[model samples]
Target: MKESITRYQFISLIILFEFGSSIIVGLGFEAKQNAWLFILLSMAGGLILYGLFTRFVSFYPDTPFPQVIQILAGPVIGYILVWGYILYFLYISARVLRDFTILISQTILHETPLFAVSLLFMIVVGFACYLGIEVIARSGELFLPYVLLMGGLFLMFVFIMDLPKIERLEPFFNIGVKELLSLVFPRGVSFPFGELIVFAVIFPHLEHPLNSFRYGVIGILISGIILLIISVTILMVLGPTIAMNSTVPLLDTISLVNIQGIIQRMDPIVIIIMVVTGFFKITIFFYGGVTMLQYLFKLPRRKSKGLIGFIGLLVMTVSMLISENIAEHLKEGLEIVPLYVHVPMQMIVPSLLLLLLFIRKRKIQKK
Candidate 1:
């Protein structure tokens, strides 16, 4: 209920949130060499979509996204719509946790069970949620600079170690146009970009709320550049073939950071980037969902504290049960999530809601 976050903090939060899982996954691998191209295009699509979503917010000043939904649609249908977003926020928070847990188990803690890794991570995530968004946004402002600095250094090392082959990106349209375009449609946009909807929940908390849209756009722009740099770096270093095939292309790309034998075994750099960004990412989504719950159920923050813990527990459990294995998880993320959940909840529903907003405005004008 406090509008405490500054515009710069909002930008930092978006950079970290968009860069969270996105840096590790969804690197435009499917498009191969053209992955970065698709990402750039996807970003443009996302910006326009985001602009529209924010416009919806501008209509209802001093309100959260859920209240906007309530205004556009009546309470009954609006609550149903808001519930869809609540589930989405919960799903993505858990999914990001699952990704971190999986990566840790596969790499550092090979002997650790998925549950244990998740358990440890959730403890930190839950504690952050307890502190709430102001603390989380402050943490982002403090840490995102390092993430970006480290990311820049990593990119520089890749280029300095050995120049990536220009030929790797040859045959420009490597994949058929349809195939490449398809990869960007809902999946690419939703994962990092469309997911900006969650920010609407956080946006209402911004002290200079009028500057919300500006910072949000800047956030997307900065994150897009980062994501683009990462995708292209992967393509240039690993080439399209290996980059496309590797499950953790960014890590794999970082693994190649052999700076004249001075900076080998740079796995820790990747881990640092992942953990810091992932923390802010999870915290924001978790907080957003919790705040929405308080609004939806009309619960006080004091009363909702227990509910937050319960939902965090639910996130851990659901993440564990999401898929039998990482392969299935990736497949579901690529095919199912975009097609069904994100497209409807993020893109489609928002469009419908915008139309409804217009209709409501006209009715009011007549009054």
Candidate 2:
């Protein structure tokens, strides 16, 4: 297991992890009409949560979150907490893989079998995981900047094509503050930002543990800003009505770009961006799950490769079995499950662990 990953590599993985899932189909649910505003508010809220999660890590710089939980909550409670997180990571990875396959089928290769596409994606991700964290991290470093730059350039083209309308964003707060705040919780805030909880496991592996909090917060902020931009871009170009109705708002908006008809059909660029970012996101989740399992079970380092492969296969199978259609899959992902399952794991559990840690510290001081 290669232990040394550069700062840039780590930063890229963090960025990819945050941006990957949201950028792909987030607009689908966000509904471009006011999606951008939701994104902005979500980012602000996400940053606050990111700060709290980072603070938790910073407080116990030398210990991984699992160990911190164990010390604070006792072995039984801590093990359950760790297991919950592990399950969360695995579920997220499976959902992402499912989402990616759905996108590919809908957009790029409509004729390809879902199983084939899913299998190929899992194979690549499994190989990357097998190569260890350093390889995955470096690959992120190499690809993420290009992905971001390309996405920016694509949006710039959309703007230049005269597709965006400032007036489309008019009638602001049309949903009222109550509805807007409600939108932020399940759709905007929890999904992307709360997902950063996975970083708790990876935090201790950083070359400089103390710096993890700084870089992690910065990474989340940057990803949020980009997501905000994407939301705004989609809203402006597609208009609220069309954007709200479209399944892939960003891709649909890209399809509308017509630079004298010669530069038309640039939706493929969106596909490229999706694929690259999706790959990075899944890889990081896979690595996080594998690492946590190994640490929890005291498995040998060399065993992670096989374990990751098994996990990938399991995810691929689960992705196929989980939902009957994309709509149902997304309904669960964006609506029902995030609030009930993810919020507790990502936000509530960590807060509980932090409180326990504080109490323990006071107890030790008194002794």
Candidate 3:
């Protein structure tokens, strides 16, 4: 927790986190051709939300979020809010761990047990969190460039191989305007974008606190572009019906890539990117959760290792038992998570904090 990350390193983590499981999870599954549109709209909203978070963090630099929350809302209420956010981080880590495990099983590790895959993955994540934020952010610096390269190569192959179809985007807003905007609120805003809530914990740790707004907005924008390209590629290659139906739309899109009948199977690159980015995402959330726990519960430094183990074990168990199948997990993530957990906590809660902060500052000025 004493270590800090550079602005570019922070941006790298954001890019990886935003892309995380979403690469294959498929967006706007219902929006179909309009998925990329929602990503754009939601990302705009996300930057605005990140702006609000920047304002909030600007109130207190060099302090952790749990303490800040406690000061803002008072002991009882702030503690509850802090706990909820930590739980949110932990739950999200579990879900992503579950997602990567399943994807690995389906694509390359058919014979590997889901438990084994998740356990091994969590072990590395646990060790990273065990080391501290600097280690995790440094790992992002190491892995993200290669991930970006894979993506660029993937795009080159897709275009050179003639896979994307322009006509698939026809009959725009097929679901009508009202429904399209509706998707932007909870599902679109809550995910890839709303997940910026974790950065609240991260921002205070930056080497330059004043640079948070800059790094945060730019990071969200870059990740948004990546998500847009991925969603568009899927829509163009697979069309609406297949995109909505395919468990992993990006993978399906890559499967269609054929460079002069030579480079047909390019799914492995997607998997590699997923695993690398997914590690950063999970480790970040884990770090967020552990840091918050240590701050809120007053765990001694000597007991910090115990705290890490408890968190890792709990997330592993929750991930394994969370669902009976991938279909159920997708349904819950799309329907349940955004509506109940994401909107109130991720969107409304932070907005309220800013409102309260504004009022408190004004009252102090008047005195």
The residue-by-residue lDDT of candidate 3 on 6-41, one tens digit each, is 988899989988888788787666788778788888
TM-score of each: 0.96, 0.94, 0.96
Worst 10 residues of 1 by lDDT: 22-31
State the C-alpha lDDT per candidate: 0.83, 0.78, 0.85
Candidate 3 clash pair list = none
lDDT of 1 by residue, 296-354 (tens): 88987767668877998999999999988888988888889888888887788889998
In TM-score terms, candidate 3 sits at: 0.96
Better of 1 and 2 by TM-score: 1
True-structure Cα RMSD, model 2: 1.9
lDDT of 2: 0.78
lDDT of 2 by residue, 186-268 (tens): 66778777777777766776788778767877787777778777778787777777766667777888888888878888888
lDDT of 1: 0.83
